[model samples]
Target: MRQNTTPRGLVQAALAMTLVGTLTAVSAAIARYPVYGGQAVRYAVAAVILLAVARFGDRSRASRPRPRLTVREWSLVAALAATGLAGFNVCVVEGTRYTTPAMIGTVVGAVPVLLAVVAPLMERRRPAPRLVVAAMIVTLGATAANGLGGGSLQGLLLALGALAGEMAFSLLAVPLLPKLGPMRVSAYSAAAATPMLLVVGLLVDGTAVVRIPTAGEAAGFAYLVIVVTVGAFLLWYDALGRIGADRAGLFAGLIPVSAVATTMVLGLGRPSAAELVGALLVGCGVAAGLGRRVRRPAPVIAVTPGRESVRVAEASRP
Candidate 1:
């Protein structure tokens, strides 16, 4: 049986991509701050906010006691914190220092491709042929849109690190989402990462953490904390729950497309011909990857006592 895609899942995926893509510009704006310091501050704030919401804000869920994480579950949360939140942010921030935003965007766009490959291994089954083809197309489009230029060797390596971290983040959280739900998973992951980020920031950057951010940096930081870290993580994980990781992962292709559009909106850069073509390809790939095959109802055969079987066709349900 084919899996069905829902509008809610699609909207969640789009919102996730938009929120994450906006981070490209946010990162650029705040690049001057020490890498660990900026990320630590951003995530620390996000963690606090998410924890508050998880604890006090959901009146509808207030009756239910919060679920406590078992040792095994805590271990998974710790892993997610390390790979997805803290490690991913660190790599991305450090990578931006050495590389252009476009380069980083291009590399990050490969996430879906990595997920497509890894999902099967984790699930112990082969991916569908269409998924593989769609992943390849998305990769090609992302590369074309974000041209491979203006980045150092160190930057490229760091970007690869970021890619690995992100892939781990997405794949690792899938199993946990069903048990904990998206909000709890996100809150715990952020909470776990926050202290680690703070410690790293203090150890690496020292007094920089105390220094006040400039107006633009402050704005960017707010966006990252509120939108990218909290909002995006919740939406993405929720979409993963609704659609499953294999389908949800395909939305990663939209990140670069959204990033380029964001850049243009910010008057930072214009899309080139290659980027335009690449955007089209990404749209096509996502549509194909998420498209569901409609199954026709099987013909009902009535067995008769006398002789022949009568075939009856049932009308398709809406």
Candidate 2:
């Protein structure tokens, strides 16, 4: 059994969270283009990268042990890939096509809030009242930040669907994290998304991703698939393993902040003062919910031959 955790774990977790946030922001930027095929593109790239990594780094199946997920677990993985990869892509892409990329960014930014509210439900755990209050506050902020309550009701609804799909991905993926190592899970998840992407690509792009994609576009797609999807998962899972799920989850709140920062750097969309404030509120809510009090492990009391040793229980925040 592992005896101790270290500072490296925390560093890895922070880096992973930041990278995920950056990549998501990048995805938002280039969301135009026939990238209507994000699910396929993401999976195709991810499969290639991960299959390579698995082969080179740890090809010994016996040493590592072959995955032994039950049928239910496999089903959950499929559902996670479909909802997180396919559903989010399809909804966000369609929403972008119908409305604007800026709007999509704003909508997607609300994912942390959705995850915060949905997490307890997935774990079959009752949430503290603070979590509920935080979620409500964040929801209100997101509504205002996205201008979702204003015009473009159709696009807003589509964005909401995308958020729901993402929440499903987060909740569904939780149980699988313990069984499938994060890298393996990501590889399989991407593999699961391949067929869906292929089907959509044939119908939408028609061999165009290879034929028409500029070098930069291809690079972007590759980055999304291999680096963002695969690398991000590996780092994220490592962090989650070291820190408990709740603490690991709080980092996700940084995604929208990263998105807005990227947008500002690109000079694409100038986030309004109100939008910034809204993002802050939403982020605060997400962190608050994910910060549900961590119950520390009880201390061990040692009994000597003639005496009992009193050990004080120490609470450690994950």
Candidate 3:
């Protein structure tokens, strides 16, 4: 079943990160809106769009019986909505109040290393040393790109929470991706997150929880719905399914890198020499980690009655 799909997966991962990076600028328009309410609207619209596309885009595929989600899958879907979607957004918004956005972003940059170690554990495999080293290099690159920024202890703690949420975003989705596929997983998670955010909006903001957005806010929501939520979520989950999470996590460094590039392009700020160095390191790390991986042959076991079993590695494929 496996083929030369890594290159395509890499491209998808990179594109997804780049799109997400642009949100640093795009989200500005919605800053004045109610946080939970705005998020609710974004997910609601995104879920609708994804459902339509996934349901109708291909006639043959659409005609096939829709796969039923198991109880475990439903639980995973709920957890994803809670931690990755709602919880992550809450941490970020609250984190920025206590810490500089740079600090929060830099903290989240550590996700590469976190995923390198944790993802393999989730898969019940030993984490590869090469991948771990590469993850460290990527984290370093992320730090250089974002630069060290000051924040309170509480801010630091909140940033750490954001990091955990970001990691959960990938780790939680790994199991579901293979079965539900990217489209359903993304659509389902977005749909699940919608009500949670809406209820939070209601409790927190009262009757004014949702207001008619201004033109700028509307435009921002449009980008978020179509590009950030729909496009990025689909591409990210698709890449995760294709390439596996540890390798895919490395591309997350591109998020801050891409954000910095966007700033430079818009004349918001010129990147420093350190930022340039950071970008280079990210490229190098990704290259090293992705070096042609050979799937190890499975082990064979022999059992005879009244004798100790024998286990040995199978011969490698030519």
Q: Candidate 3 at residue 208, lDDT? A: 82
Sort every candidate by lDDT, greatest first: 3, 1, 2
lDDT on C-alpha atoms for all candidate structures: 0.81, 0.65, 0.88
| Candidate 1 collision pairs | none
lDDT of 3 by residue, 1-318 (tens): 131346889999989999999888777789899999999999999999888887785565766778798898899999999889988988888888888988998899999888988998987999988889998999999899988898899899989989988998999998888677888889999999999988888888988889999999999999999999999999999899887888889999998889889888877888899999999998889888888877787666656778787656576655
Query: What's the CA RMSD of model 2 in angstroms?
Result: 5.0
> What does candidate 2's lDDT look like per residue over 1-318, in tens digits?
121235555556556766666675566535555664555666777877887776665666648766688999989878977777787777876786567655765566555445545665656766546656665666655555655433277787777788777666556766777767667777787888888766776787787643445666677777776667787777876665665344444555555555566677877778888779877886676556545465767665545666576656554544
- Whole-model lDDT for model 1 versus the true structure? 0.81
How does candidate 2 fare on TM-score? Answer: 0.74
TM-score for all models, in order of appearance:
0.85, 0.74, 0.90
> In TM-score terms, which candidate is top?
3
TM-score, model 1 to reference: 0.85
